[model samples]
Target: MVHLPNTPTREREIKLSFLSIMDIWSWICELPNLDDWSESPVFELVSSGQADQDGSTQSVHLRADRTSGSESEAAVIFTVCLQGFPPLNAEKPLWVSEKCHVSRENPFLPLIVQLVQEIIALSPNAPNSTCPRAQLQKLKPEPIAWVMDSHSLESFSTFFNLVFILRLFWLCACDAPNEAGSLYFQSLLPSALEIVSSSPLPVLRTFLVTVGIDTELCFMRTLGYVVAKLCIFRELGVGLQVLVPPPCRSPGFSYSTEAHGVWALKGYASMMTMMKVASSDGLKPQIPRLDAKESVLKYALAHQQLEALVQLEYSVAFNDGFIQVLARIDNIRLHVAKLGFKNQNDEAEYGEEKHFPSRVRIWVGPEVGATYVGGLSLSRSTGNAEKEVEIQKIVKGHFQNLKLSKGKAVARTSTKTKMKNWRMDQEAEGNGAIFDAVLYDNATGQEVATGRPYGETSDDPIHGLRRRYVGANRPFTKTGSVVLAGDEYGEEVGWKLSKEMEGSVLKWRIGGEFWVSYWPNQAKTSFFETRYVEWCDEVDLPLIPGKMIV
Candidate 1:
């Protein structure tokens, strides 16, 4: 429970209130004939007659309309005690209701009845105990009906302000569940859309601010979900126009950040989904024609100047908005490459340079067997090519030169040949090995140092070492060992291999020192073999190759 200095205790209270309010709004929105209820007036006041003989008291009747029908109405009769006047000031009367009774046949009478029943059901049974009426008075009907009937901008503005404050409080609260807030927003989406569509631009702007659209604390998931749902509706074009008003239509239109831009892209994605759904259902979808220059996706890719091109690429790749667009584009990788993306492997295929190191050192462990010798190599294309260079090698060895036990025969010649080239392509044909050493610095604890071959492009040097020495297909044993691979200088780099102890079952263990041997391009012989070598605890080298030691 880390608490910030600025966070107040009322934050949780405000968040719960917002969720309750939204839930209430959702229930009201889902009610049948809401538009009719909003227009038809739920309550009507009628005066019956004078209450007393002196006409000092009066009787007032209040009728509430139910959804059942206009003819069936609930009526509440109240006897008002007026102060010494026959004809009292009805509008601003100082009269108090003395007695009240509601009609039993009223269908609208049980709005609070269900809630009261629920409370009573939850209460514990006590012997001859009277339930307090004051406790029950705390429960009241939510003012959703009032909000729906509010036509004045001022009322809406005040309501928006309250919601805004509640949302702000929730945003600053550390314990608030973001998903809960998102769910509430999703539930109230229909009502929110209705409000946004009906409100004027100024009012809409205020409402947007209340929802944290232009604020630093904007809720992206909720906003995206609402906009996505709206995009699926028939008023797709109009909804987008309202949310993202074009600069030409309104010169003052602006967004605080690219958050809205990302959401707009999501909306576009949802629109595509809607179109697909419509097409599948044998219905025509009214697709809106958006200006390319004003488009969020186009702006993000073309001129947004994002700090990380990979981020934009990922957003487009994963975002629903760009799915159809990506499918339509023949060469999305090339398109992204032209947008100055260089970190991804797909972009590397389109790079100008094909120069790779030629002289390579191969390392192998005792698991490679005792019959063959092999090493790793590098190759590159001479001219412009579209293929990226390859790295990794695996070798299996075969044994030869056997002597019979019965006869005294001379030992036969042993030979080995290269089994597989990890990189078997024409692009790396002209590859020349660069004299770079792969060193692991124990002092700084760096896994792969800058001096390693292809260090700039390779992020995981330990993986490379594993592939080179452990014979790609071999399973790792529990014991630890060092395998070295080097250039022509014999200044080999070593990787320490060890099994993870926690939750690991050690099925096999290999002991003693050994070396990996291989014969390249040989006929009628094995390509790889693991031969016995003198065991040493550590190599007398200045730098290691891997971060972990066995």
Candidate 2:
């Protein structure tokens, strides 16, 4: 048994509340008595390095009653949060890591400080910036529990970059007569009439200069989210982007930019989301809606139930042509076939072989005239390809180890010799199949809104995201994003506006009905799934200066 420190109760309490000399609120500002609100972003780092001999550890932040009272140990977790950076090449997006910082300040610290100030101001007795310490006592700091997506530094950069962009939109509304920021704004946009691209990097530079945001931190915040070469697609009404906040942003959590200074936005998110859908099963699915002719398409409807991890961001922007929008569904995966179970007594039930759908189509845009962005036709998966691959692997390994005849070939296993439970994913690793996703209307029987599909890629654009994970290199096409369809390009990707709706306030309520229909390949069952998502709302569109209004 290990002997622990026998620290006195009073001594432990005193140390726990060391920062109590001044409450958290008082610590943030310079005593709050001076007329200065300068140096507002300050944080206290507390650590209790003491630990037990067995090496087992307990947190020091635990409540006084919960402690053993026999041992006095400090847990440096809080210190790590302040100073440490997350791991490199983290599978999940990391928000901020000390790994990437400039000078002494973490780029995220300022945003956190401003947000905390915003929250503090919401209390019944808000802190008076010019008031003395006695009056500052009214400001109570609310406890915040952080739920991060992953330990990815990208998350942090995205957060800061997003706030900077939303603030730009807020500036867009105010720029009409931006008296306070006009001098700086004019320098970036030579003529108020000259439109600036809404890309994150460009907007960040704009925010840094016009709003006096830190220069180094802005680029550092992007982590180069937008890859080069795709920037042109972004301009051609292809905002070619969509964003759902990173992981752990579950219900009850809200991400809003704090309105602190001239550059600050009034609680606008760079990511605008669809309001609550009137549908009965909004995100909660009852059962997969199977269209009999297309076979059973059991979609992994919830993130908790996803077969593979995926990150998605949807973006829509107005241009002179039409509305260009794309919802990037990364890590796309789907089940086309499964090994069938003949008897019910087995541990798990498998279905018959499912191949890639005959045709996969994507629709995204307003409810009435939804744009059919594109369609994909996959090669039939009815052959013995999977068995052939396995046989080749087994034969190669067997021959290599035995140093046997070079003429040896592995034969297909007969019915009795075959493993009863043998099963393999019908498609290849990443995306089992690859074919040109063309722009066509024949893929669906219903009356598609975007005129007729203009044949193939040469005719129109294939506005689909090619999803591939580290090991899953195959290009599998799944419909989980917004694919807008249009004829004459106006402000968006491929669609043109009606003659009546020009120069009008567009109500941007999007209802995307993703119909994944599959005819039989080898599997006899035929079914499809139609999922209606209120993909976006008018509230999602921003009020840009020259760009179309929300």
Per-residue lDDT tens digits for candidate 1, residues 1-550, read: 1122222112111112323333332332233442344432211111223334655332221222233323323232222122222344242222122111233332222332232223233332111223332233333323322332433534443344333323322222223233222222322333343333333334333333332321201222222222333333313232223222221111111121122111111100111111111111121146734434223221121210000000011011112221110101001000001112123232233222111111112111213231211222332233242444444444444345545323333434444432222121211111112222223322233322112222222222222323321444321111111211111122221122231222221111111211221111111111111111111111111112222122
Give lDDT: candidate 1, residue 376. 20
| TM-scores of all predicted structures | 0.17, 0.22
- Please identify model 1 stretches exceeding 4 Å from their true place: 1-220, 223-550
lDDT of each: 0.24, 0.24
Poorest stretch of ten by lDDT in candidate 1: 327-336
How accurate locally is residue 360 in candidate 1, as Cα lDDT from 0 to 100?
A: 16
> Per-residue lDDT of 292-386 in model 2, one digit per residue for the tens?
43212221111001111112233444556444443332222222212111232221211221222212222223334433322222223433422
